[model samples]
Target: MNLQGIAAVVTGGGSGLGAATARELARRGAKVAVLDINAAAAQSVAEAIGGIACVCDITSPESVEAALARASAAHGAARVLMNVAGIGGAKRVVQRDGSAAPLEQFRRIVEVNLVGSYNVLRLAAAAMAKLDPLDDGERGVIVNTASAAAFDGQVGQAAYSASKGGVAAMTLPLARDLAQHGIRVLTIAPGLFLTPLLHELPEEVQRSLGESIPFPKRLGKPEEFAALAAHIAENAALNGEVIRIDGALRLPPR
Candidate 1:
């Protein structure tokens, strides 16, 4: 599937990995839609890439529907969907004081990370299924963002890890379910990256985190993640797999 002149939708496109992917897609000639909860941030990225900006609440169907409508109206039905919008927080099952963690906290993370991703993927794939095949019966591709914490969650990350784990667990089954429609599904589980939030930390803290990686001794770059996503879109054979974009970093249990 060539990206040239095709419609692509990226959630969380306001910043971090999604923004990087949107830029890369635009560079490859794809008509991009930048979706984010923050209207201003989304608009900024969209403007930079000459794409449409759509404000969306990933956890709400109505919001997502409206966002997609605007995207499709402007760029046609999306053939590439990237589910990148998510939230994370650290909380143990039991607090340090021995009180049980609030169930709402866990639910919130799952709602935004796992359920939200599935919502966008389903909607985008439905649109993709209607389009004519581009090459070798391939109609579209969906790339989801997971995290290495899904596999090796440290202490105080129960909610965050579980949410990400659900994303990873669903990858293969989603690919299998959508295979008949000529759509491919893949997940990228990234390790520590210097995202905006992390970058705001003290310099020494950032360096300490980067030094923990097994190789390259630094955080992964958003552009690097975007580059792999571009490759997945072009290489039709790569499907039903979760690629780890970590620098061989196996998170240790805290």
Candidate 2:
């Protein structure tokens, strides 16, 4: 899909990977809609890129649907949808308190990371299906964010890992289901990215995390993820696959 003049929606565009992807898409000539629960952050990024910002809470279907409608009104139905909103919650299945982690906590993670992604994809794909196909009969592309933890989850990451794992597992079937409509779906399993979660850590701890990487010994940049996303958006053949951007680092159990 040629990104030039295409309409795109990026969820969680308030900051981090989502923000980077929105900027990159804008740079590529796509009209972007920056959607996030943080209205101020979303508006800031959207204004910077001359795009629209729609306040959206991915976990709420009404919020997501409303945001989609707003985005469509501004940029037309999106041909590219990027699902980058997620939360990282940490807890042992059984805490030091000698109690199992509350089931609500686990369910919340799944609600946002897995179900939220699906919600946006469903809405976006439905809109894309109504559009005329571009090159190679491609109508749209959907990119989802997962994490390397899905494969190498450490201690205190059961909920986070399971949520991301669900995202990874759903890629193929989603691609297949949308294939007839000329829409492609792909997933990215990022490793040790320098997102807000990592950035908030103590400097020494951040360094330790970076050093954990086998090579290049640094946190993955959000722009690097954006680059890959842009490539996937343009490449029709890259579908139903989860590409890891973790510098050859397979995390060990903590």
Q: Give the TM-score of candidate 2.
A: 0.98
Report the error of model 1 at residue 41, Å.
0.4
Segments of candidate 2 deviating more than 4 angstroms: none
Q: Give one digit per residue, the lDDT tens place, for model 1 in 43-91.
A: 9999999999999999898999999999999999999998889998988
For 15-49, candidate 2 gives per-residue lDDT tens digits of 99999999999999999999999999999999999
> How accurate locally, in lDDT, is each candidate?
0.94, 0.94
Please identify model 1 stretches exceeding 4 Å from their true place: none
- Model 2, residue 121: C-alpha shift (Å): 0.6
